[model samples]
Each structure stands twice: as C-alpha cells, then as structure tokens.
Target: MIKFLIKGILRDKSRSLLPVIVVATGVFLTVFMSGFLKGIFNDIAELNAKFNTGHVKIMTRAYAENKDQVPNDLALMDVKKLLSQLKIDYPDMEWVKRIHTGGLIDVPDSFGETRGQGQTIVTAIDMLSPGTHEVERMNIKKSIAKGSLPVKQGEALISDEFAERFGVSLGDKVTLFGSTMNGSMMFNIFVVSGTLRFGNTILDRGAIFMDIRDAQLALDMDDAASEILGYFKVGVYDDIKAQQLQASFNTKYSLKDDEFSPQMFRLVEQEGLGDYLKLANSAGTIMVFIFVIAMSIVLWNTGLLGGLRRYSEFGVRLALGEEKKHIYKTTIYEAMLIGIIGSVIGTGMGLGAAYYMQTYGLDVSSITSNIGMMLPSVYRAEVTPSLFYLGFFPGVIATVLGSALAGFAIYKRKTSQLFHELEV
Candidate 1:
C-alpha cells in the first residue's frame, strides 16, 4: 500500500513538487537562523571570557564590590604561593594571574619633556609563565596591528588608537605613572614593542598591556595580583560547573565576616551577565517559535489548496467503495514521506551554508565602528547538534499537521453526493 502511494506521488508532480519545495525552504531557514544566533551568543561569551572575565575569577571581596575603581590596594598578596596551592587543590583547570590598574602614559620628545600624555587602563599579563597558553588563548598574535609581541622586560603593547593619539610608534619609550599597593608613588619607563587592535572600542580608546613582572615592580606590588583567572580544559564556558567551582573555592578560601577576604565568582555571576545571557536565550526561543508558527500557517494554506484540487480523485475513490478512513490515512502517509525527504535535503544544504559561514565569516567592521560596540569584525555561524535536528520540528511536524487537518474533509464527502458531483 505504501509502495503504491509512493509511486502515485512520483508520477504526479502536482502532489509532491510544490509541497516539498515549501517544506525544504522553511526547514533551511529554520536551521540557518538557529546556527546564526547561536554563533553570535557564543562569540560574545568567549570575548567576555578572554577580555573581561575568565570562565571563573577570584578577587578580594572589597575589590569585587568596588571593581570599577581598579583597586590595586585590595589585590591578592603572595599570588605565587596562593597559585601554587590552588594548582595542587584544583588540578583540572588552568590558572593565570592578572593585574588591573589605571595610569598615565607620558610620551617624551628629544628634549626629555612630555610631548603627549593620555590616561590609560593598564592590564598586566603573565608573559613568562611556564606551561601557559594565555597568548594563544587570547589570540594576541592575530590581534597585533603593528610591530610584534613583547619578548623582553620593560616592553609593552599599546592600543593602536592610543598610540596614534599620542603620536607614538614602535620603539618609542614612554613613562607610566601609577600608585602602588601601599598608596605610594610609582613610575616606570617602557618601550612600545607592539600596537594591538582588538576590534573593541573600550580597548582601542586607551588601553595598555604590559608584562606582569614589570607591572609588579613598577607598582611595588611584589607577588601580588588583582585577580586569578581560571579556564576550562576545553576553553568553553560551562555555567553549572563554573558555579560549582566558584562555590567550592569560595567556601574553602573566602574568609567569613571579613571585608578584605577573597571571593570567587563564576563568569555569569560577574557584571550582571547571568541575566543578559538568560534574556538572549529566551529571545532565541521566541524567534524559533515565531518562525514555526509562520511556516505552519503557510503550509496549512497550501495543504487546503492541494486537498481541494484532489476533490475529483476523492470522489472517484469513494464511488469505488473505498473507505473514507483509508483515504485519509493514505494522505497522511504521503505527507510523512514528503516531510522526511524535504527535511533531509534542507538540513544538508543548511549545514553546508553554516560551515561556510563558520570558516569565512561576514565582515561588519563598519557597523561595529559606527556603534562603538565591543564586537568582532567578522560574524560567523555555529553548527551544533541542535542545529542538525532543530529543523525537523517545523518541517516534519508542521507538514504532517497541516496535511492531517486538510484530510478531515474526506469524512464529509458522502459517496452518493460525490458520485453525483463527479458524474456531473
């Protein structure tokens, strides 16, 4: 019976061609949109992880509350000792130390007088840490706009925009003046080794990156760091695991009833990110639902037209003593086959497009520059397991649902009436 139905559909283009095209087109769009949105969210999360927050972070309670000030005085002391203990305690995760501070960069002319000066946000990164992949993880090699990464002490990477504004270039020596952890004056001379462009407005405006040892020496903050960042082995954020780690670490390390005690925070806990991510996920779900409803309505209308066109055929079958229930069931089986075929083809095409987008993304530099947002130049699609089967919900289910609704008309067609209508 199924073979006969398949053969009939093959012979009749009107019964299969248009419906297949509609279902395939709808499924293709559904898959593409899912991948595209997932890509955007994933990209943003990674950027935040690398630039602002790690998968998890540890800092002083006072600094966590007043982090906007870049409070070096509240930084963790004896970082090497603490990190050693942390490594032994939690060997599953990678750890990196960082110092955040604010300072003034003074560019000098040949006469030793200041030529230009800018207020800058400074980030001190571990340059000589053994067994660390911070450089590769941050993509510092690719983000370099001029010169190269710093290889020696007293060298730093300044933002391209900051360098341009100060009329500075590679090999230029500059003075950085900042406050020490003990509320004392601190200053150091640094040669500009590289200029970096992160494609982010915050970094481009007035940012500086320096070696951790140099920063510690300049600030007189020996063996101290603003925060200790933790990353997963896979370099991806897992909310539940991160939160669990944070809870365990805080419970173990945090001092109770002490304002200066250190505390741990998951990526989602800091900067109100938990709410933002939840909202973005909800928005994606709403978008998928909207697409499904819109496609279902369109397919439903097409099914009604196809059913009306088959009125004569149904009448002939009814006059020949075929049961109405049997005719209805056959229509459902035919719709199921069409749904399967269309979904398979559409999913393949969508995945191919997604892979292309993932490899070579669309450049939106102009858009990001205009908005002054922290966005990358290229936007890519993310292909996941969900993307592979997400289209099936709308493709197979909607097609079958629309076809089933249309088939209900089979019951209203009386044999005598249909024969008279057909004979006329």
Candidate 2:
C-alpha cells in the first residue's frame, strides 16, 4: 500500500509541493530564532561569574542599593563575620573575600588629567592574589596595555578605552586622586602594569582596578571592607544552597548583625540573556497560521478538480466490483505517504538551520546596521524540539485533510440511484 501510494503521489508532483514549502519555511524560521538567544545569554553569564558576585556575595545593604555606594570604612555587619564562621564551621564554604570602594581615577599630567568629576571608578578588590581559582581567575590581565591585574600596593590596571582616550601606554606612572570613604581627599600614584579590554564600551570606557588594601587606604576604609565576596565548595552551590546561606545569615545574625544583615547581599543569580522570552509567542503562531491558510487555499483549488479528474478511474474500478472502502483507503494512503516524506525532509532542513545558528548565531544586528537604528544586539536565539515538531505536524495535518476532503467530495462516485445518468 505504501509503495503504491508513493508512486501515485509522486506522479502528481504539482499537487504536493505547496505543503512541503510551507513546512520547510516554518522549520527554518524556528531554528533561526533559537540560535540567536543562546549566544547573548552565555556572554552575560560569563561576565557575572567573573565579577565579584561569584555564586553568592554577602555585602553591606547599602552597596546593594547603589553600585556607587562606597562605605568609606568597612562596617562590620555581623553577616560578614557570620559567613566567615560558616566556612570554618561547615568546611563547605570556599572562603569569603572583601571589597571596599570604586572612585574616579585621577590621572596625572601625562595626556589628559581628571581634574573634576571625570571618568573612572576605583573599586577595591582583595582577590587579586595569584593562583586564585575563585571563578577561574579571568585573565583580563593578558589583554592589558600598561600593567597587569593589581596584586600589590601602588599598582592599578586601567581600562583600554580610557588609555586610548588619554593616550596612556603600558608601564606609565599614573596618579589616582579621589575622595576616600571618610570624605577626606587623598592622592596615590601607581605604575600602569596592565591595560584590559572588556569588548564592551561601557566597562572599557571608565573601569579601573586597584588592590583591596590600596583602595582601602585611598578611600580610608580602615580595617572594614565594603562588602564580603564568597566562594563555596564546588559541589555545594546553586540557588538552594545560596538560599540556605541567606537563611543562616537572617536566622542567626539578623539581630547580632549591626551594619550589615539580610538586607546586604542579594542571592547573586548570574545574569543571562533572557531577551528572547520577551518576544511575542503569538508571532510564530500568526506566521504559521498565515502560511497554513495560504497553503490550504492553494491546495484546495489544486486538489479539488484534480481529484474529480480521477472520477473515471473510480468509476471503472467500481464497475469491476472494487468496494468504496478500497478507493478511500488508497486515497488516504497516497495522501499520508506524501505527508510523511515531506515532513521528514522538512525536519532535516530545520535541524540544519538550527546547527548553522549554533555555529554563527542570528544576525539581528544587520537590522540595526542597515537601518542606522538603535537596536539591542543578540547572539543566540531560543530553540526547542517543540518548534520543529510544530512545523512537521502542520504539514501532515494539512496534507491529510486536503487530500481526504478532495477524495470524499469528488470521487465522481455514482450513488446507486445515479446509475441511469452514468449509463446515459
């Protein structure tokens, strides 16, 4: 039956091409979008994982409120002490690190000087130690133009964007002058040992790195750190564990903690590109509907008269004592065979599109670049098995319905009462 159906359907190639085109197009679009969403999310996650908010961070609540909030002195919020104790008490925490402030970097008389409120933020970091593995120790140091990641006193890494803007090069002595956490002004100079490029315009434009101790001294942080950064045992990580740590802080140190407490650090969830989620799902639905509707109209006209033209075959077969059921079965078998083959081909094309996207990603930026309009660039698009499945099912369903309807209505099948007409 399947072999016969295949031969019959292929014989009338003109009648079956429309559904194949529709299914193939739909599959391509689905995979295209899926690839774009994946790339953007990965970049964001990489950035978050490298920055201070590794797995989880416990900080002064004020820092959470404002990224610019530089508590001049490290205020001992019991939460910091408690997190330290948990690492010792549990042997499950990776060890906590402290951070203090980010101030405007004041460059001396080299190229351009930051006299007033200029560019740059001098954030304090303590994890500049060599051989540190808290987040794989992102090697922004290698991308440096002047110096390396700050580990010692009087050494600062300038952002590449800033260096280019000011014409500062590697190994140049630069001055950092800004107000301390105490609101008292201070000036410190360091050798430009590293210049790092972030690929992002914003971070490269004004970001600067300094040792935790230097930042504390420059900002008058005293013995306190602005916020406590944390790393946990490799296996003991994730939201649930983060929540448990949060609970421990709130339940154990809520009252005992003075300056810092539950309000301090948020459960540092990694940033991911979730922009695809914002796209209207109805968009795909509407496109598929139009495609289906268009195919139905085209197929209906093609199949209707086409099936009626086969009336002579049905008439002769009936005269030969072939039952009506046999004719219907043959017609359905032909239609399903065409539908299944087209579906297989369509699925293969769709997966190929998905794999291509996995390699190069969607080019949405072309829209912006061509039109000169401001648009957010995305990397990978969101994809799922369901999208391909959706495409294949519609082709099969439409094929069966179109074929069955045409066969049933136009078999030119003579009713017993119509025998006289046939004889005449």
Candidate 3:
C-alpha cells in the first residue's frame, strides 16, 4: 500500500511538485543554517584553544586565582616530569607547557642605545620539540609576514604590528627587560627572527614569542611553567569531555591540605570565557529555532494550498465509497514521500555548499583587524553528524503536521455534499 501511494505521488505532479519544492527549500535553509552556525561556534572555540586556552589547562591553585595577572610566582614545579607522566598516562591528549609574562622590548641602534621601546606580552612555547607541530598548530608560521621561524637560541618572533610601531625589523637586536619569578630584574637579548600577525588586536599589538627554554632561563623558572595546556587529538574543544577530565583530575589531586596544589580548568572555565562561550552557543540555538519555526510555517502553508487544490479529488474518492479516514491517511503518506525526497535533495545541496565553505573559508581579515577581538579572519563551515539529519526534523515534522491539520476537512464532508462538490 505504501509503495502504491509513492507511485501515485510520483505520477501526480499537481499533488507532489509544489510541496516537494516547498519542503526542499525549507530543508535546504535548515541544513545550511545549522552547518553555518556550527562552523562559527567551532571556529571561535578552536581559536580560543589555539591562542589562549586548550581544551583543558592545568595551573597552580594560586596562579588560577590570580591568573589575570599572569603570576609566574605560583608556576608549576617539575613541569618536565609531570608532562612526561601525563604523556605516558594519557597518550590520547597532547600537552604543552607555556610561560606568560610581560616585559619591555628595547630595539637598540648601532651604538647599543635604545632606538625604540614597546611593552610586550611575552609567550614562550616549545619550538624545538621534534615530536610536536606546535608552531604549525598555533599557525605562527602562517601568520609570519617577514623572516622565518626561530632556528637557534636567542632568536624570537615579535608581532608585525609591534615591530612596525617600534621601528624594528627582522634580525634587529632587541633586549627584553622584565622581573624574574623571584622579583629580581632579568634581561635577555634576542635577535628578532620573524614578524607575525595573529589577527588578534591585543596579541598583535605587543606580543613576543620565544622558545620555552629561553623563557625559562630568562624568567628564572627552570623546569617550571606558568601553565600546562592539553588538547584532544581532534583539535577541537569539547566542553563536556573537558569538564569530565577536570573532575577526574581535580578529584585525584585534591587541595585539602596543600595551598600550592595544581588545578585543572576547562576552556570555558578560564578567565572571562564562560560568558562568552555561553552567549555564542545561545545565539546558535536561537538561530536554529528561528529557522525551524520559519520553515514550519512555510511548509504548513504549502500543505494547506495543496490540500485545497485536492478538495475535488477528496470528494470524488469519498463518493466512490472510500472512507474519509483513508483519504486523509493517503494525503499524509504522500506528504511523507515528498518530505523524504525533498530532504534528501536539500541535504545534499547543503552539504556540498558546506564542504566548499569549510575548505575555502570566507576571509574577513579587514573587519577583524579593526575590531580588536580574538576572532579569526577566515570563517569556515564545520560539518558535523547533525548535518545529515538536521533537515529531516523540520521537513518531516512540518509537512506531516501541516497535512494532518489540512486533511481534517475530509471528515466534515458528507457523502452527498462530496458528490455534489465533485461536479465542478
């Protein structure tokens, strides 16, 4: 019986064409919007992970409290040993140590006198690790506008904007003047190896990148780190998994008696991030909801239009001794067929477009540079499992619901009235 109904729907263009088109259009929008929004959310989360926080981060209890200050005094001790143990225990995750500090970069002239000065936020990460693609992962190499990656000791990368502001260039001798973890003044001379632009206003303004070993020596924090960042193999943030990991880690390393205990934090739990992530997710939900509601109304109206056009057909069926219920059920089955066909076509179109967007993202660098936010310039679509069936929810539900409501008129028509109405 279902096969017969599908055959009838295929043969009857008047009954199937408009509804199929309507459903396809609605589902297309649904799939496209969902993928687009997912892309934006994932982009924001990934950028956050790459630049500031990872999926999970481990910090000293005191440092977590005063994290905004980038307090190196409460940095983790014996970081190398802890990292090695973590690698052995959790091979699925990649962990890296980082030191965050601030200092004055002085570009010296031929006479060794200060030619330019700029305050910088210094970040130190593992550049020499043969096993890790930290430089590529962070996109530092791609962001470089001049020179190349640091290849030797005492070499560093400064933000291109910072270099321009300070009248500095590649291979320029620059001296970093900052205080050590113990409150003693420390200085390190480095030759600028490259100029990079991260597209982040704050980071690009006065950011300096150095090798982790160099930072450790200069900051007087040997074998210690301000924070340890951990990421999953997928290279995307998973809030639920991060929370679970944090719970498990914190439970095992309870701070009951120790004031200097290490604490684990999910990406969203980091400073000033919880609200931002929440807002972004909430906006995506609202967008999907809006699409569903709008599509439902559109398909609903299409169903009503199709039902009205089939009024005479319904009357003729009832006149031929067919039950009103049977006619209504047939209409629903036909709607289902249309919904399925439309959804398949629409999902295919949406996925194709999404793949394109994902591969070659739209560049928004011009706008991002002026906003002074930590947003990436390229916006790409992120295709997920939901993209396959996301359209079906709106397509089937809206079509079936609209048909069910519109088909109610069949029950109201008496046999005599149906026959009389069948005339013209």
Using TM-score, rank the candidates from best to worst. 1, 3, 2
lDDT of 1 by residue, 1-424 (tens): 8999999889888888888888888788878877877777777777778877898998989988889999989988878988898898888888888999998889999899999999999998887666658777777878899999898898999999988887897999999988988899888899999998877788878888888998899888888999989988777889988878888888888998986777888988877778767876787678668766766677677778888888898888888878999999998999889888788777887788888888887888667864565666778888889878888666888778778888888898877687578876
The lDDT of model 2 is 0.57
The TM-score leader among the candidates is 1
Worst 10 residues of 3 by lDDT: 287-296
Alpha-carbon lDDT, every model: 0.84, 0.57, 0.83
Model 1 ranges with Cα > 4 A deviation: none
lDDT of 1 at 173: 93
Provide backbone clash counts, one per model.
0, 27, 0
**TM per prediction:** 0.95, 0.64, 0.94
For model 2, the stretches where C-alpha displacement exceeds 4 angstroms are: 7-12, 15-18, 41-59, 67-102, 110-117, 123-127, 130-153, 179-183, 211-217, 220-259, 263-344, 359-424
lDDT of 2 by residue, 109-134 (tens): 64455533345666556545665553
